[model samples]
Target: MQAPELVERMLRGDRRAVARTISLVENAAPQLREIMAGLAPHTGRARIVGLTGSPGVGKSTSTNALVKALRARDESVAVLAVDPSSPFSGGALLGDRVRMQEHATDGGVFIRSMASRGHLGGLSWATPHALRVLDAAGFGVILVETVGVGQAEVDIARHADTTVVLCAPGMGDSVQAAKAGVLEIADIFVVNKADREGARVTARELRQMVGQVEHGPGEWKPPIVSTVAAKGEGIDELLGRLDEHHAHLTATGEADRRRFARAREEIEAIVMSTLRARLGDVHGHAALDKLADAVATGHGDPYSAADTLLAALDT
Candidate 1:
């Protein structure tokens, strides 16, 4: 279908169109410029939330439960599950979809699994574009479940309006979250598998850690919720906390600030990608090779070579 037709259909909530648009984004199709232009005006209406944690933390289970809670409230939801890439096919492992099969037949929920494709940040490099597709498709809320690649998962904070970090009892997740630097980025923390032993200890450690970080007056403090997600336990409380965080974001104008930063990051990424592509071209590569030779031989400084390359691109 033409870009305009695809955009029109997607905006009308056509599931096939939404899927096809995300495919185009993942492949970086030539039609994206037009498609994105057509969809841009309709974007920014969806609440984007990100869920991340270490493996075995029941991130998928919690996500499935959250989807149920959100749908019960009559909200339209889209789930973007970024999964570890398969070595042979470079596609998502599909584990997340398998776990979420209960929602497969629910028209109110849209679920997509994307392969991280070796992206180090727990997300596919195409994630931001795919998010735009979902947002323009009129999903009231979008849940971005990142590949549980500990440490590097902080990238989700840049893409999401609210970030939920999950921890499991006995996983040493509180210490891990602190080590991974996710504690600073989390808006809400979930101690999933709360029925397990050490659950209270995990929650206590989280609370103590949170208390240590002094927030300026009126600054939002991350709240920890305990959940045994496999049984749908504590999901309503989790949803309530999510609502509170969203309200806090809007009331304090943090939502606008976050969105502005997200847009700026997106734009900067595109510019960097364009530059890298151009630098891979034959002429630019040749220039870089010559500059590298000069630098190795002490004939030119690295700074001067970089300036020359940038000058070449401008011309």
Candidate 2:
């Protein structure tokens, strides 16, 4: 279908159109500009939530449980499960469709697995665009589940309105979270596998850590909720906390600020990507190569090389 038709279908909540549009985004198809333009006016309606944590933390299971809760509330949800990339084909290593089979047939739920494509941040570069498509497709809530992230891979905070960090008991994840600076990025900390032996200790550690942060009067403090996600335990409390955080964001005007920042970053990323593409052009590439050769031989400096490349790109 044409971009206009696709956008219309997507806005009308057509699942096929939503999938096709996201595919276009993932592949960086030429139709994106027109499609994004058409979809832009319909976005900003969905509530975006991001889930990230270490491996074996039940992130997927927690996400599955969350989807069930949201569906019970009669809300439509889209799950963007980002998986590690396959080295050979750059495809998503894990198929979320298999893990989330219960929701596969639910019209109110749309689940897609996207490869991170070697992005060190644990999220695909196309994530923002894919989110826009889902939001415009009329999903009430969008869940972004990142690949198992390590220290410095907490980019999910930049993309979502609410960020949930999950940790399982007995994994030393609580300490790892502190060391990784994830403590600062998390709006909600979950101790999944709460039925495990060390679950209470893990939750206590997170609470103590959170309490150490000095928040002024109305500042939101991250809460530690324990859950056995595999059995859908404590999911209700998790949902309640999500609601409370959303309300806090609205009451404090932080929601608008976050959305503005998200938009600014999205625009900047697009510009950077476009510039990189331009710099890969024939003239720009040749100019850069010549500069590199000169710099290597000590005939040209690195600064001058960059200047020449910029000039070539401008031309």
Candidate 3:
């Protein structure tokens, strides 16, 4: 199908169209620019929630429980699970679609597993564009589940309106979360597997850590919610906290600010990628090779070589 027609179907909430469009974005298909352009007008409506944590932190389980809770409240939800890529095939290794099988038959729920494809920061590079597709598809909420690669996963904060960082007991996850710099980015923290031993201690440590942050009287404080996601315990409370955070953002006009920042970052990323591609094309013409040889032979400094490459782009 043509990009325009595909975008039309996507805006009408056609799941197949959404999937196909996302695939095009992932593969960098030739029609991607047209598809994104067509979808732009319909974007920016969905609430984006990013979930990140260390490995074995029950992110997938918590995500599944959260989906059920949201569905019960009559909300249409879309989940974008960013899984690690297979070194051989560059496809999702830990497919969240398999983990979230219960939601497969639900018309109101859309789940997609995207390979991170060696992108750092726990998310696929295509995430921002895929989000545009989901937002345009009329979903009330969009959940982004990262690959959970510890500290670097903090990138989710820039993409999500609300960031939920998960940690479980007995894995030193609390300390790791602190070291990972997730403490600063989390809007809501979940101690999943709350029924396990030491869960309260984990919660207490998080509370203490959160208490140390100085905030204005009206500033939103990150809430640490305990959950046994496997059993669906505390899912309601987690959802409640998310709702409270969203309300705070809306009432304070922070939502608009966040969305605006997200757009700015997205635009900047696209521009950088375009420039890098153009640089590669210039390199193919041997302009870069000569510069590299000059630098290697100590005939020119690296800085001057870089300038020459940039200057070549102008010609």
Candidate 4:
């Protein structure tokens, strides 16, 4: 089907259409621009929640539990599980989808696994666009699960409305989060596998860590919620906290501000990518190579060469 027809079908809640659009985005197909333009007007309705952390923190399990909780409240949900790329096929490893298979048959739930494709920061480069497709497809809540790459996974904070960083007992996650600056990006922290030993210690350390940061008056404090996701424990409280955070964002007008920032980042990313591609075009590359040779031989400074390149692009 054509891009416009596919978008219309997606907006009408056709799962197949949604899947096809996402695939187009993931592959960076030639028709992507048309598809995004068609879906643009229907976007911005879904709540984008990001889940991230180190491996073995129960991110997948917590995500599944959270889906059940949302469904119980009659919310239609879509999950974008970003997994590591398979070295051979350059496709998603599919581990997360396998773990979340319980919801596969639910009409209200749509689950897709996207390969990170060597993109750092734990997300596929196509994630934001895929999210737009899902939002336009009429899902009320979209959960984005990032690849569990320690430290570098904090990029989701820019794309998600509510960023939930998960940790587990004895994992040294709190220390890692502090070092990686994930603590500052988190809007909520979940200590999953709470039934395990050292659960309270983990919670206490997180609270203490959060307390060390200074916040302006009325700033939303990230709450530390505990959960045993495998047994579905504390899922209700987790959902409640997410709802409370959403309400806070709306009440404080931060929701609009956050979304605006997200759009700005997306636009900037696209522009940079386009510029890079333009720089690598045949004619541009010939000029770039001469400039590089000049710089390497000390005939020109790097900054001047960069400026010249930019000036050429302007013409």
Give the TM-scores of the predictions, in the order they appear.
0.88, 0.91, 0.91, 0.88
lDDT of 2 by residue, 1-315 (tens): 999999999989999999898888767889999999998898888999999998799888899999999999999999987655342463442456476577767899998877645353322347888999999999999999987666324667888899999999999879867888888889999999999998989999999899988989899999899899999999999999999999999999998999898888788877877767777873645677888999999998999888877776677
- Model 3 C-alpha lDDT per residue in residues 62-150, reported as the tens digit of each score: 88898999999999999988654342463553465475577778889998876645343322347788888899999999999886655
Tens-place lDDT per residue, model 4, 1-315, is: 998899789989999898888888767787878988888888888899999988799888899899989999999999988755342463444564575578767889998877645443222347788888899999999999986655336667878999999999999777767778888888999999999999999999999989999988999999999999999998899999999999999999988998898788777777766667776773556788999999999999999999988887777
Model 4 misplacement above 4 A: 84-91, 96-100, 118-125, 149-152, 282-315
Cand. 3 TM to true fold: 0.91
For each candidate in the order shown, give its overall lDDT on alpha carbons: 0.84, 0.84, 0.84, 0.83
Local lDDT at 103 for model 3: 72
Predicted candidate 1 versus true structure: per-residue lDDT over 1-315, tens digit per residue? 999999899989999999898878767688988998999999989999999988799888898889989989999999998655342463554575575577778888998877645343322347788899999999999999886655337777888999999999998767767877888889999999999999999999999889999999989999999999999999999999999999999999999999888888777777776667776762546788999999999999999998988777677
Error of 1 at 249 (Å): 0.7
Better of 2 and 4 by TM-score: 2
Q: In candidate 4, residue 12 scores what lDDT?
A: 94
Predict model 2's lDDT versus the native.
Answer: 0.84
Q: In model 2, how large is the Cα lDDT of residue 169?
A: 92
Q: List the residue pairs that clash in candidate 3.
A: none
The superposed Cα distance between candidate 3 and the true structure at residue 207, in angstroms, equals 0.5
Worst 10 residues of 1 by lDDT: 116-125
